[model samples]
Target chain A: MKWEYESPRKAYGETLVELGKEREDIVVLDADLSTSTKTAMFGKKFPERFFNLGLQEQNMMGIAAGLARSGKTVFTSSFAVFATGRAYDQVRQSIAYPRLNVKIVATHGGVTVGEDGASHQMIEDIGLMCGLPNFRVIVPVDSNEVRRVIRFVAYEYGPFYVRLTRPSLPNITSKDDEFIFGRGAVLKDGDDITLIATGIEVSYALLAAERLEKDGISAAVVNMSTIKPIDKDLIIKYARKTGAIVTAEDHNIYNGLGSRVAEVLVENYPVRMLRVGMPDKFGRSGKWNELLKYYEMDDAGIYNAAKKLLEVKK
Target chain B: MSDISPEKIRELKLIANKIRELTIKMVYAAQSGHPGGSLSAAEIFAVLYFHEMNVDPKNPEWEERDRFVLSKGHASPAYYAALALRGFFSEEELVSFRKLSSRLQGHPSLMVPGVDMCTGSLGQGLSAAIGMALAAKLDGKSYKVYALLGDGEIEEGNIWEAAMTAATRKLDNLIAIVDRNKIQLDDFTDKMVILDPLEEKWNAFGWRVLSINGHDVVQIIRALEVAKEVDGRPTVIIAHTVKGKGVSYMENTAKYHGKPPQDEEEYNKALKEIEEERREI
Candidate 1:
């Protein structure tokens, strides 16, 4: 399935409004970025349920924690940079430690928030959020998958961190497919190498598998969307069958999907692997596509990494 | 306001003395708890727990019961002492201060029946208190919310943001008490960062201000009574206090802000002084 036109953040906002109508307990809190984060649509319809907390992200997190303590399901929205980085302690202590049912809806993830510069991009958010206990970290591949996640996180009992993107991307999953937590989607299968990816990198991995196949290299593409409670069973099964793995993501290599995949394979099925992500450096201000290519987060980078891993396996 | 008899004031003072003694015992036993702020906050906690607030210890979660948040969580000794004395928990629980897996943690948590919010991070509790007050208003319940803020912790930006929200919402059911002991962790709040003209600031922020001698049994009770009368605006009871009020060596000292009482000799001496004061009462 392919999206006609829609960003993952927009999909999240629309789905939230639908959930708001179904549940009276659902409330949306924005730190003066409702329009940019795409939560303004939900705010417009569910005006009473929406809270514009001005530019105070730290206080907004505290307010959401308070509301959650009072038995309200809260979704706090802001740029991932500020939401996770600036208010990290408040989220850690108030929301995450208490295990509140607060959904941390962060938009403008990774280098996708182009032209606004490195300060706006949040390549380290997943790493930061996943380190906290009792947090479910999710990064949807596209708008369709994000719709599924919006419903899943809203009804979930504990704290959640949903990393959404600012730009539009092609939808990769069909509506009828069942989206399970901690389960990986096997988009395409092959025999030689397993390409495990998460978030926006999932689509790139799919495209890279296609390119690899033309050169007689069969590749298996697995979308490891849920990062924290990662689908280790799938990664191991695919690694045993394929014998080599390539992990890719639009995040840092230190604590993101790459690190998670390596941890699983090293413990279970020891296999040759290659990790592709930011090379431990700050992102620069540029067009999103140009930055992706510069940071080696493109299909070509995945294909090249897979080729190198194949060499080690042989 | 109903007049509190002098005998009742003496009785409340005895209760406050007992709380201070228990607080000292807990910190001395734990060997790693704050004593200064806990001592300074003792009288205020005594008044709130014994007289000002409408709370049933047997039913800690009673819907209409008043809520209190200890924003300055380092002063948990005083809060735990008050709760234990008020029958929220067993007195034996105080012995397990800062111990692993104990309900009496270094900070107040909702796991304890009487605690309204899990607060340790400064400048965040007022917002939680405001939320509780908002919930009470929405539910048409007349329950009040009280939050104790440290004079030093007021420098945090989130506290001001919450102050703005509370006044804008006209949370008259919410009352904030600033434990104005004037000392922070390392130095005097005035030396570290001046929060002088604090009364004017709260007044400018739309909160009705009440100044009182925090340790005066009569004045704390009077301030709280006046706070309840003001409708349509949040009330701030600025209670001026000596950092370590009861102990002679520790009085007005920032060094005692987070330090526990020393050896058995010093502990016995402090206990003797408190006992002598009680005997005079």
Candidate 2:
């Protein structure tokens, strides 16, 4: 399989710089973690438009909301944990309630923050941010998608939550491909089962599909990047077409991609679904690969869950 | 900044008294509202709505209009009362404060016309005000942004973060006023957390600091006028005030911070004081 090196965080940072040049209304804010979150690129290029609030996440969120109220398209960058949990109330009342045009671009999402431990790792951000009204939560599978979604969210005015990972991931989708913010992208075609995943898990879903293909199971792979909108029509169509489904994500099994897909299925399709994610537990300090293995968020785990669900169907 | 005349000052003082009376009546009707902070902030609220802010009650969302954020949002009674009195909404709506289906919540929300941002969480408003100021600079708009903070709420770290940003950004169009009533939810702010040397701290953070007796309408107006002329840095007016002004028994008392008038006798007494003040005017 061909793979390209692309950092989703860096891609986001670069895209923000481009957006800043094109639209004067676009301003970037970082909470003293710009170098880590990759928003330093935007800052270097547009010093006039960039603001560093120095590790004050709550204040940063409120400032972004205020900027939105003043008709400036604002993007605030911080760690996923701080962005979602630390300032949840600020995001809820100031930004979401007002339906402001602010974008929260959070990096180091999931256990992929590597040696930073559980304090920095955020597996629950998707759940927390998606629960908010008027908040569009997007977890891009690769760097190409991040670039696309930045532009998409800029054009679509409202509050948005973008989850980015630290480690470099495979660029499964090409730059030439057209990607929409709220719409899910289908990666592989199959009939027996549908494999739905988001963020870092999307690449894993593709690998699982490849493994399943060799095992003679024709599995369809869907990159469900936009968690909030969920592409309801696509979820319903695939769940009904395929009698079995498997969802993989670097998030909690509850209130994340799995829970949303289950919501769609239980209501309409009533199909058998298996959720492959971090079991109801927080991550511990370890290597990224070890953490992924421990949480059962890898290809083998996805393949095993798929087989288990197929067996249940039989 | 313009020079204030004695006549203008007298008119503002009358409006401030009217605002205090309306706030007391609204809180009494709601039966569960913050009256102390509301009463203390009445003068500043009146000055913003009646004289300072270029707001249109009919066009609440006018993009070019000046913005005012009640950073100390528990004092929303004063804001709601002032807005109603300013024709943003009907005075009848003031009776619905803190009710189940009322727009007048314990905290200020954007549901009310002329309310800029939904702020109740303390220390969050100044950051938003900075955003508005920065936006004005970016868009090349001349409209100014004003934010009011409670002395107690300044203890929250986010307010300092905003203060640093406002000063660093040199947001001259932004003016911040701290209602230094020296009292918070349960007790005096000195006992809670002494934010003394408050003016020096703001000045240290690169702001132009000014101190005024908040109840003195003329002094408050003069300070606000000076704040607009400062070109390079933000201005913070430390307005020292009594917690519960206008009410004889409630002044400087923490019990009245969150509690409304007890019975008809208290409400009548409060109204009588306001009537007497009006008669004096």
Candidate 3:
């Protein structure tokens, strides 16, 4: 099947415009990076509702909380590092503690934020957001799912954290695919090993599954987009069937997708698992593809991890 | 804005005295809470709740009503006293200030009837007020937003960021009151971090700056009225007040900043001082 590449940030910006037209209560805020985060698209359409709070991520989060408290559905955007790391306390006390109706759609997540180095790339955003109570974390696989997730969180009345990558990704899911909030999407079915992935790594997992098929190893691919409130039933079903699992993500291996899946498997059904992601180290200035390859988050790396998991299962 | 009458000033002063007494009693009951800042801002709270703000204790969640955020959340006793006196809740609940099951926590929380935002950490409430003011402009509502900050709380960098945004957006419907009580948890505010030239700083940030005596009800009310009439840009009222205005023993002392009365003799003396002030008014 032929696939096209699209930017999730662009999709998020377009969806915000659409949502603005539909709901008058929807307000968008950005901390001086609207162009990079693609919130400038919404700003152009609804200048009255878009607030440009220049370079103040902490104050932006607090303002988002206050807007939500006044019955406005607020969508705030910034770089992943600033949104999660710089203003974490504001997010916790103002948004998460009170459970305000705010959507924090952070862009440039993970090592895909190429050339910006460790300072800009946020590999621990998932862990940071997931640590907060009443915050639902979502990382869409591609631009198609980004639109669905945006629309979903717009109407939903609660706090949420949606992460978007900087680099464009291949469209893996179709337009007809349903984007459920907490449910995982199964792209392929197999019995030998299960490959659970999220964000841009979903496409890499699919490529790894194809390679594993040639090696006489059936690899099941599951898109665990919603990191918090994770699909435990789907993971257990795949664990019972495949008996081996490999989790992939464009994040640190410690407290991200791999850790969540390992927690689920250990509690319900014990299975041989391997985590394919950035090891415990900061990323340097490099190209997006080079960073992924260097961190062992590409198709070849995922395939190797799956083979290693299969060997451990034997 | 009309001139405040002598009777109105006397009434507000009495109310401020009652609020101070209530604050001392609540802190004494809690045995662990901020009393210095709370006592200092009693007049500010009384004027805003009883005279300036367009709030309804009966309908606490009124859509078009004015909003107040206690940025210096440790001074929640003052806020709770004002809210209770305004009939948002019973004055009897003041005894349950920091109890586990009480609606009144150590800081201001939204679970309380009259409170709009949950603020315990410093330098956050002003940003929330800016958001509320912006929302009113977007929705075409006439409601105004107000926030009160401690003198020491302005040391946080986030406060400056929010101040700049509030000015840049030209939030005329927003008014911020700085309770310049001159003391914090550790020591005097100037000793901790010199916020002198504070009025000049606000003027540079593009806000209409007003300096007033925070312990004077008439001055506080007049400043709020003038702030409402100011056009285009937001207003900041720098209210100079003693650390513990009514209590002679605790006045200008950081010892009572976050500590309650030590024993019976101290508590009685504080109560007697406020009661005498109320009678004099």
Q: What is the TM-score of chain B alone in each candidate?
A: 0.98, 0.97, 0.98
Residue-level lDDT of model 3, residues A88-157, one tens digit each, is 9999888898899999999999998989999998999999999999999999999999999999999989
Candidate 3 global TM-score:
0.98
Candidate 1 vs candidate 3: the lDDT winner is 3
Q: For each candidate, report its DockQ versus the true two-chain complex.
A: 0.61, 0.75, 0.80
Q: Which of 1 and 2 is the better model by DockQ? A: 2
Work out the TM-score per prediction: 0.96, 0.95, 0.98
The positional error of residue B51 in candidate 3, measured at the CA in angstroms, is 0.9
Between prediction 1 and prediction 2, which has the larger lDDT? 2
**Colliding pairs, model 3:** none
Docking level of model 3: high
Q: What is the lDDT of residue B220 in candidate 3?
A: 88
Of the two candidates 2 and 3, the one with more favorable DockQ, higher being better, is 3
First chain TM-score in every candidate?
0.97, 0.98, 0.99
Instruction: Give the C-alpha miss distance for residue B123 in model 3, angstroms.
Output: 0.7
Check candidate 2 and list the clashing pairs. Answer: none
Task: Give me the displacement of residue B210 in model 1, in angstroms.
Answer: 1.6
